[model samples]
Structure formats: structure tokens, C-alpha cells
Target: MKSYDTIIIGAGMSGLAAGIRLAMFDKKVLILEKHTIAGGLNSFYARKGRKLDVGLHAMTNFAKKGERGKPLTKLLKQLRIPYSELALNEQHRSKVVFPNKELSFTNDLNIFTDEIISKFPHEKDGFMALLEDVRNFNEVSLENPYESAKERVSKFIDDECLREMIFCPLLIYGSAWEDDMDFSQFVIMFKSIFMEGFARPEGGVRRVITLLMKKYKELGGEIKFRSGVSEILTEDTKAKGVKLETGEVLLADKVLSSIGYPETVASIKEDLEVKPRVGKLSFTETILCYDKKPAELGIKDTIVFYNENDAYHYRKPKTLFDEKSAVVCLPNNFEIDDYSDGMIRLTFMANFDLWENLSEEEYKNEKNKVLEASKDIVRKLYPSIDMEPNFVDIFTPKTIKKFTSHHGGTVYGSIDKSRDGKTPVNGLYLIGTDQGFLGIVGAMLSGISMANLHCLMPAGAES
Candidate 1:
């Protein structure tokens, strides 16, 4: 059996990041991925000669200067990956259309504030106060559980509509939770997305994964695809190795699981004394529609938020699709182009259990129903464009579970600011969306944080 100093389960960004760092330290590392690809959520698939990303609509924290100087750029520099900026049009920076009125959010805070003031002059003070809260929340620096963030925003912003418009969508993007989510978790995301501009890689998010994989391989790290780990071997209540699906056992000194919190815990065979609440949490399901490119659809590079009103309402379990939701547009480019046929991608929150119960046949029918409903929502936003899409792909919680091996197919492993993020399990480290923070940047940062902790500990130190 092959052996190494450490074995990382999952080849997603967090796992790859951990491998790159460990390999750099001259430690032998092996990454086991169940899927054929390496990027996890960052990876993409090809259909009819075109590539479609599973998720990853856009990114922030890639900016080189100003607010971008924090974590993301620092990691890229360490990894020796080079990136360039992609500009957004001033007119369509970000548009949010509610039932009663419309608001435009720009990269420039002053421009964005002025636009909001123009539309709702009566609520200018309230709007400015809300912006101040977001800015303050973004500026504060704290450790993993951001206790200050939760306190600050709740104390300052009392208007439900304003909070719903400004912070609710961010909550959706961050944790599949609404605005009422823990403020500290929301603050980490706010700093990443708002302080930094929305960005895409030169090729796409897949390129980010490819770059990391190349670096990992160059550092002599090993990766085995289609080799799923069925169980984690343990001795004396400590992790020792992993058992693969093929009945092959490999030993290692340490094991880091980026597959998400629940699945990772389930893989551990030992009946450990300490068990944290990692498996129970909610998730956001995404549906993607692709085609040659819709004609006469004047799209922008911006993400559009569609809702009836901006009110922060905490959604109960299994009630994800009940509320008024936002539809995000992910197009090739924002500008009107005739050179090539275009494709539009739409994503929204969905019910996990609802989709998991459907059979293959039932899934196809339910997928059609979701597509039709989504199409109607999109048509209402962009009425000028035609509604016939060439292809439709729906991903439920089960899909995420099957592909990523995350418990409950949760986009993130576990909800943040909860007991899970701080739960101490000997020899088992948890990172990625399940640890609380979401988004590409958040996942990478979490991995880096865990790596740093591991690096500081003494040999055989309990983590």
C-alpha cells in the first residue's frame, strides 16, 4: 500500500490548497478524489463542445490592490499563480429590481449611495446608516468566530427592508441562510465580495483548480481519482489511515478531510468521545440552463437580484423555495455581442429533501418543472429575450452529496458561528463551506487557517 505523511480526502479547492501547503513543507501528501475531476465545485463539464461550470458564478478578493491585499492575493502570490483583472460596465455594475422599485449597486460606494438616494430620497439617512454598518462590519478584523460582526449589525440596522436588500442576498451567497444568520459569518463574506470587486479567472474558475493541481503535482504530491474512501481507520481514538472502496488500506500519520464536516465525521470508524453537531444544516440548490446563446437578450456582466421586497426572514428547514428569491445571471460577457452565440446561467435556493426523494424518472419531470418556473422568473426580469433554452441541468442536495460526498449535500459543510466550527476532534481538521464561511475565497482561507494551525502544533499534537 502507498503511504505518506498526510492524506487529504477530497480534491476540492480546500483539499488542494492543503496539499500544496503541506507539500511545500516537504511533507509527502496524497489527495484522494471520488470524482474524476480535481476542482470540486470549481470544476466544470463539457457538453456539445462547450464547457459549463457547475457553480462559481463569479468571484471577489482577486483584486490586486486596495481591499484585495488581504488573504486571496497573498495565497496566490505564495502559490505563484498570476491573474488579471476583468472590468465591469459602470451602467450595469449590479442591478436589483424589486416589485415596487429598482436599485443599482455600483463598485463605487459613493455612486451606489447616490443612486439609492435618488430612488428613495426619504430613506437616505437609513440607507447611509445601513451602508455604514456594512462598511464597519467589513473593516473589523477578528478570528474565526466573528462575535463582533453579529453584534454590530444587529445593534445598528433596524430596518427590515434595508437589511433585506443589502444583506439578505449576501447571506444567500455565503451560507444559504438569510440575513438573520450570524453576523460574524456574514462579515467575513462582506469583506471578501463587497470590499473586493467581482472577478472571474482568465479562463474560468476551473483554471484556478487546474493551477493549484499543477502546483501540487509539481511539488511531488500524489492524487488518485475515482478512489473513494469508504472508511477512515483509527486506533486508540486517533486517525491513522483510510480504507478505500476497493478494499485497499493506506496508512498515514495525519489525515485532513476537506470533503465537508458530516461525511468526514461519518468516515471515522472509531467511536470517539467528542462528537460535534456537524451534519445538521441547510443548503442552497442550484439549477443551470445552457444554450447556444439567447438572441436579443441584452445581458450585463452584473448579477441581478429579483425579490418582492428586502426583508430579512429566516427560512425554516425544508422551506427554502417558499420565499421570494433572487435570480443571478452568469453570462459570457455583459456587453451585447453578435460575434458568438451566448449562454445564460441562473441559480437560486432550493429544497434539498424535496429533490432527493425523486427517482431518475421523477427527477427528470421535476427538473422540467423547475426549469419552467425558473424560465418564467427569468422572463419576468428580461422580457425582451426569447424563452427557449437548449439544455437544462438541475443540481439538488443529493447531487452535491453524490459528487462531493458532503453530508446532506450541503453546499457548505456546516453552519458557521455554530458549535461545529470550534468543535475539537483529535487528528481530524474541518475546513471549507461546512465550517461556516462559503464562497471560493472563504473556502481557501479556511484551508489556509487550518494549515497554519497544523504547522504550529508540535509533532503528534492533538488538534
Candidate 2:
């Protein structure tokens, strides 16, 4: 049995961040991952010389300055990861196409406002008031407790199209809760994106994960892949160690779980005094096409959103693919030149309950259905590109569950953002998106916060 000061379960972003931070502080650390790679959802795969990112498309929160201050860049600096930014075309930062009309949201806030005004000239007052509401929500989010994005939208904007264009997509993109999530929480999410410009790492998100893993190893942190923890050994209501799938018992002073709360407790198989409420966990499903070049799709460092009138259709249980679709550009210069020849990645949120009980044959059939749906969306958005893709990669909620061990393959660890970021048991910590936020920056911040709290506690003080 191997022993360490800390054992981090799941080597996703949160786990890696925690391992890096703890190791840097001279605490012996070990990160155990069920998959061969370190990145959880952010990892990529190669098929027939084509590389496809599992879930990551374009990332936000990398802006140099924001209302809440510099996020991605600041976090990178603190982690000692060297990074450079890429420019997203202001003309087509995001294009929303509905049945009646299409609108483009630019990177510049003023341009975005002007474009909206031009489209809905008569509703100029409504548009300006909506922007003000967004600004006010950002300013007072940390203090207020509004309970639904829809409520906030109803209060600020009366135009259905404007509300659909903004809040509808925002709800679909951020959480699994169909447009009815807490308003304050939704506002904070929106503020992070508008106030902070979104950018992709020069080499890809995997580069960021790889650098953090390297730094963790440099600090004497150990990692064991394909070693899933089957049980958490406890005594007197405190975690003491873990038993791996291979029956190897490794003891640690503390265990930090980057996986979701339910999965962590399920693995431990113990009754805790406090149990977190389990809401719907959102899964990001994508079908990556390597058939066309970036320019062929009219994509130039920009993302495309195809608006669906029925965003609520996702609430009903469905397969890995849904009606709502978004396409992201992946340029050849960003990653490996060999496989990056001509790649465009398409992603959408999937309902976890839809694929929770599929057989092998059923799963493949459902996957094909998803691929077909993605093709339909692609044809509508990029008319120039061919419908058939040279290569396609499909990731369902089941695939996510197998790799990350998150309940229902939830990308985020928890849904309740109001609770203090803590588990019920002592010496146990929960980080990552499951708690309600998403993105690489948010995951890293959670890990950093947990690690900081742990470091402040004296050695052997809790265990």
C-alpha cells in the first residue's frame, strides 16, 4: 500500500489543479485517474489522423480584464503556465439564426448593442433597458437572490425574440435547468462571458492541462491511471484512505474528490449526516467533423449558434443529440498540424437521463441519430460545407460517466452553487463544475480555493 499526505480522485482539471497546488506547498500528493489521460472532458482523441476534442470547443474567461478582474489570464500566471491569446472575429463572434431572422453578436459590447438596435429598431428602449438589467445583475449578483433567469428576463425585456436570443441560449449553454435556473446565478455566468472576452489557448485547452500536470509531477506529485477508487475507508466519520479497483489499499491523511458529490459518496458507500440534493446534471455532447477547412465553413475564430424555437425540447428525455446546436472553429495552427488539416467541432448539451439505460446496440443507434441531427444543424449554419463529414466523433453521457465517474456524466460537479463548497465529511472536498459553474477557469478556481483552505490547516490537525 502506498501512502501520501493527500489522494486526489479523478485527475480532471480540478484534481490536477489541487494536486499542483498542494504539491507546490510541499504536501505529498497522489492523483489517481480512471482514464489514461489526465484531462477529463477537456481531453481529445484521434481518429484516422483527425483529432477531436472530447467536450471543449471555444473557452471563455481568458480576457485580460473583466468586471470581476482578470480571470483566465490571471489564473494562468498564478499557475506558471505560459499562454498567448487568439483573436475572434468581431463581425461573427456569435451568430444566432432563428426561423424569421438572424442576428450576429459581436465581441464589442457597443457593437452588439447597435446590432440589436438595428434589428429591432422599434424596441430600442426595450433593448437598452435589457442591457441595463444585465449590467445591474452583474453589479449586484453576489448580494441578491433572484431565483430564475426567466424571471430576470421577464422583468427586463418584453420582446420574445430578444429574450429567446439571449436568455434561452444562455440557459441551454450554462445549466441543464430549462431556462428556469436561479436569476442571480445565471447573471453571474453571463457577466463572466460579456465582461471577460473569450479566447482559446494558442495550443488548445489540453496544453493547459498538460502544463499543470507537468508542474505537479515536478513537485513530486504522483499519478496512477486506470486505478479507480472503489471505496473510501473511514473511521469515526472521517475519511482515512481508499481502496482501488485492483484491491490496492492506499492510505492518506485526506482525500480530495474532484468528481461529483453523489459519485463520491456512492464510492465510499457510507451514510453521511448531510446529503446534497441531486438535480439534473447536464452533459455536453459533440460531433466533430474533419471533412472541411475552417474557411470552407465561413468560420474565422468565431462560434456559430443555430437558434431553435424549442430550446425547451431538451427538458424532455432524449438521446445524446438534441434540437439545439452550436458550432465552434478549430484551426490547423492551434494544435498538431498533421491532424488539424480541416476541422470544425460542433457541440450541444445532452440530457443525461436519455442515455442512462441504453444497451450497446441501442447506444450505437442513438449515436447515429445524434450524428444525423448534428449534420442537419451544420447544413443550416454553414451552407457552403458538405453535409457528410470525413470523420465523426460522438460522445454520450455514458462515455462521460465511464471516464470522469461523475454521476450521470455531469461535467460540473454540483448544481447547488449556494452551499459552501464543502462535502459533508471531514477531510473531504468537492470542486469542479458540478457545483453549478463550468469552464476550465471555473474548475481551476474551485481547486485552487480548496487547496488554499487545506494548506492553511496545520499538518495532521484534522486527521
Candidate 3:
């Protein structure tokens, strides 16, 4: 018999943000989470006395306090959270390594531009033109049509190598499509990673989650952990409410789902006209803990996008995992080293179906291989790192599926994004990854934007 003004599904970045926004406006909001914990994908776990973060390397879209028009500033302002609470530390620098070429960049855009100009001297004008294009494009517009990023970027840059290098980090960090991403997504990632750059909260992602939870509760928002939604109850193609896995029904005037696009469709029994395909991209990450920090080992880079060949293969692997390419993150290389011990996280593209078909013992053996490969990559990148890690943990696509419940362990969600957040069913909306916004900042923005457009707008107002 109970009803809420709005019900937000999943306690991920987007869901929590939506709940907080709705509650701030005095709307009775309820957040239903399937797991006991919050921070659905970007969460943390304690294992053998060590706290490890999941799905966080470096938070992109870093901005200084009170920086005008920046994503980080806008996010905090919208959530009414203070920038000081985040305690963010900027990255020292990151690199993109492809065969004989290596380009280094920091929080400064000039450094990246200079690197490009220094290496690809002939393409400086083209690069600047591309940057202008990215700046002028209204990437956030809901009505914009999808265009191939590679094709568009090629018009600006002549050399294929420079283009591949440019896209290495952007594609791996945000794209749902293989090899390339939408032009709009490309611009978003470009500005966030290259222009604004990376930073990390002092306590990793947990601190951010804690702040949102505290803020939401203070605003009188309700969140039920372990309350899994079994079905989105609908009538006449309109959302009625939701049926929990426990067979309990809760009514809501509107529903916002952050789980994913395809997953959302699967929850409803009605044969809707739209059927979004699940994204094929997945990853396996190897976490290594060392007694000595990376700086002590003479490593200065915060993160490195590594590729053995000229081409960057940012897609699902045919094998268990792609060994030639990886995203190696040195957490200790940040401006401030908060961890007691050094840590390195290596992420490799993986095939979900291959990992899902393995036996228990086979899975264990495959994980060991991934760990060895990770160590090999470290040795290759840092030849001085000869000692074995004190602790090592590897997670495959199966782990991603088990924890986040994203089909195929898809990190970026469905390829068919609902840019406007509107579904075929009235009173239903999509946010987070499937909504086309990416990273921690993008996810929160998606939630806030959707909530404002759908629930907070005045009667008869345009969305």
C-alpha cells in the first residue's frame, strides 16, 4: 500500500545521485539496491586485511575548487557537496605507448598538445582544429544523431598512428562500441581525460559513496539494500511500480533505472518495440600490492595505456583475454600517496562468453595466467621492478557479472543508448552508462539531469 514520488533502481553512482536530487526537492524518493553495499560498480572490498577498490583507476574530469563550467564543479554544485570533502589529488602524468611512439601528458592540456606537436609536428594545425571541433560540438544535446568518431577525427588528422594513439585511452575508458565510439562520446571523453585530466579521492571511491549516502539520508531519502527488483510492473505501456524479488510490490509515480538499457528491457514482460543489444566489451583486472611504492622503484607515470603494436585493439578478445594491450595504473604515482603500500592495477580486454564457460578449476588456472601476464607487463614497462608482489588479486569478466549483474559483464552497458533517458514506457527513464554519459562524473550528471527533466520540472514544462 506504500507509494513514493519516485523510485530509483540500483545504488550505483547514477541511482544514488538521482535519489539525492529528488530528495533535495522534497520528493519522497526510495532507492532499491540488490546488494548489501552501495557503489554498484565503482565499489570497494576488503580481502585478507587489504582494502581494494573495484572499477576505479583514476577519476577523470578532475577540476579545481570553484572552477567555472567544469564537470566536477558542476557535479558538486548540483549535489550541494563541497569540493573539499572529496580531497582529490591530481595525477603526476600518464602516457600512451604504441610500438616506437610514446606521448606523455598531465593535468595540463598544453603538455599534451606540445607532446603531439613535438612528435607529430606536421599535424599540429590538424590537432588544434580537431580540438576546436570538439570544443564547439554540443555533445550533450539529446537530439544529436550518432556519428563515427574515427571517421570524423580522420578528417582532422592525416596520420593513422596519431589517430590511434589519440583514441587509445578514450575508447578503453568510455566506449561501448568496438574499435570506435560515437562522436559525441569521443568529445565527452576527450574533454574529460585530456582537457581536465585525472584525479583520485584520498580514500578512493568509498569516500565519494559515503558522502552521497550521508547527503541522501540527511535529505530524508530512503534506500533499501538487498531489495532486488524482479519486474517493472506496467499497464498500458506505463510504469506502475516494481515487484521485488521477495514478491513485495511498491508503487511509485515515476521510476528511474540505472542498471542498464538491455537489462531494463528484460525486466519488463511487455513486448516493447525497442530492444537494445548488450555491449560485448568486458575486462579482467589484476591488482598487485608491493612493499615499495612506484616512485621508489623510479616509476613516475600515474597510468599508462600500453599497446605492443601500432594499432590499438579496444574490443572483446577472441581468447580468454588480450595480452598485447592493457591499461596499467600506478595508484601510488598520484600527487599524494595515501596508501601504506604501493599498488598497480592492470586491466585487459576479455571475452565474457569464454570466461563464463569455464569450470571452477579452469577459471582458477586462467586467473593465474592473467596474473603472470600482468607481472610480465609490469616488468616490460618497468624493467627495474624485479621483485614479486606481496599480494596479488585478479578478477575476470565472470567477477564483473557476479558483482554488478551487468549482462556479459559489459562495463559500458548497451550499444544502443537512450540519450534522452526516455523509454517506450511512460513514467520510466534510464540513466548512468546506458544513458550515454560515462565515468563517475558523467554518471552522476546523467542522474541529476534526468531527475530534473523528468520529475523536478514544473507541470506542462518541456523536458
The predictions' CA RMSDs to the true structure, in order, are 3.8, 3.9, 0.7
Q: Return the candidate ranking by TM-score, descending.
A: 3, 1, 2
Q: After superposition, how far is residue 312 of candidate 1 from its true place, in Å?
A: 5.1
**Segments in model 3 whose C-alpha atoms lie over 4 Å from true places:** none
Cα lDDT tens digits for candidate 2, 95-136:
556767666654456756777789878778876776677666
Instruction: Provide TM-scores for the models.
Output: 0.86, 0.85, 0.99
State each model's CA lDDT, in order.
Answer: 0.63, 0.65, 0.95
Task: Name the regions of candidate 2 deviating beyond 4 angstroms.
Answer: 65-68, 85-92, 121-146, 277-291, 297-301, 310-320, 324-339, 417-419, 457-463
Per-residue lDDT of model 1, residues 29-112, tens digit only: 888989898878667877665566777666655455433556667766555555433232222366666667666654555665
Q: Kindly list the per-residue Cα lDDT of model 3 for residues 100-194, writing each as its tens digit.
A: 99999999999999999999999999999999999999999999999999999999999999999999999999999999999999999999999
Off by over 4 Å in 1: 65-68, 84-92, 120-151, 176-179, 273-297, 309-323, 334-340, 416-424, 456-463
